[model samples]
Target: MHLDPAIDGFARYLATERGFSVNTVRAYCADLCGLATFAEERAVGTVDGLTLELLRDWLWEGTQAGLARATIARRSASARGFTAWLTRDGVLPSDPAVRLRSPKPGRTLPRVINRTQMQDLLDKLEVAASTGDPGAVRNLAIIELLYASALRVSELVGLDVGDVDLSRLTVRVTGKGDNERVVPFGVPAQTAIVRYLQAARPALAAADPGATRSGTKPSGSALFLGSHRQRLGVRAVYRLVAALLESMPGTGPAGPHALRHTAATHLLDGGADLRAVQEMLGHASLGTTQIYTHVSAERLQQSYRLAHPRA
Candidate 1:
């Protein structure tokens, strides 16, 4: 079969058989398409004709093109997936990408804000909300809930009014893979959310009631609204967080995920159990959550060196 046709078949297999999400399918398809184009440029026309030499050359060309290590690694993984599937389905006698390897990228510890810095950021948000700006109130609620819940940007923006239970102080979040988890926040986030819902959300909703019917409810169900009173987008959230970080000092160029890392690390530093933090962050593996333990250990070492008398 032609390479393009085989690629399409594999994508369908991933979607139907493996039940991959649309984003995953699109990413895999893009990687495989790039590989197929590389192979075609090298005069290899069929899936069975792909060889290890061609695969290596493709990776080399990607490197030459200045692809980041992470991107190259993903492309290599895509090649392996395609070759393995072809061999398994009897389209090829062997997988050419079995031995293909990309350079391992260095694992930099995630950047987290210190406790004082976190307090300062929240203090600023509180001050902004106190100005009686409805948008400021909503922004404070957004930042508070983001840090408190350790939620991904998508999860935060995906929130609906019904997803939160102010009485219970819990939020029902649909995380990655559509997994549902109820997470709790403290009084600060609760206070901010309450203020936003009561004082800010009404003004936001009134700005664009969004296609209402006589005696029927308005269509604005999103918890966060854009200027157009539409659901807040991920980029807008990113821009807001970035702009907030610009006024704060002594922090890296980290985005909303930094807040998540900081929140998780702070939980661990405050003597919260590791496994509990893992569940709260919605991480599937406890191993992934163990990074915060390292963060805690480093902090402990710093304190010990500063306070201990022994040389």
Candidate 2:
């Protein structure tokens, strides 16, 4: 089959069969689009025309262009998945990417804001929220709940009013694979959420009626709403989190996930159980949540060096 239609079919398979998220599907689509362009240049227009050698050369070109090892690695994975799928579907006689490999990206420790920094950041937001601006109030609630619950940005935005049980100080979020988990937050988050629901949410929901570009009805059930009264976009959350973390000392990503990392690390530092942290984080594997242990160790070493008089 032609590469274009084959790529489309692969995307649907990812969404339906693999249950991949929209962002994952989009990333795969983009990476495969690059492969498609490269294949076109080589006059390899069909799925069967793609060779392992071409795949390697495309990754090599990415490396030559100084793309990060992580990016190249992701591209390699995308190509491997595409070829394997095509082979399984009988479009290709064999998987061309069977032996394809890319350089493994180095594991960088996640950035975690210490408790003091987190407090100061939240304090600043609280002061801003004192102005009673709906967005500012919502922002405080967002960061509070994010730190308190360690929620993924998608999960945070996907929340509905009914999902949160303010009386119980817990929220039900549909995480990856549409799995639901009820995560608990602290008293601060509970208070902020109550305030937002009572004072800010209604005001935000009653925002401009003409802002219907997202095709979502204004004043929808989304827990977080933008000025348009529609569910807040992921980009808005990213922009807010990125701006907040920009001034922090960090070598890694400064996205909403950083707050998650910070939250997990803080929990571990406070002697929270490893398995408990994993469950709270909605991690399927205990191994995935162990990274926060490393962060805690590093922080402990830093504190020891700073406080201990011995060389």
By lDDT, the best candidate is 2
Q: All models: lDDT?
A: 0.86, 0.91
Give me the candidate number with maximum TM-score. 2
Model 2 lDDT tens row, 1-311: 78899999999999999988898999999999999999999998888888888999999999999999999999999999999998888878878899999999866789888888899999999999999999999999999999999999999999999999988999998887667899999999999999899999999988767765666677478999988888888899999999988898768888999999999999999899999999899899998898889888988898999999993
Give me the overall lDDT of model 2.
Answer: 0.91
Model 2: residues with Cα > 4 Å off, grouped in runs: 210-216
Q: CA shift at 148, candidate 1, in angstroms?
A: 0.5
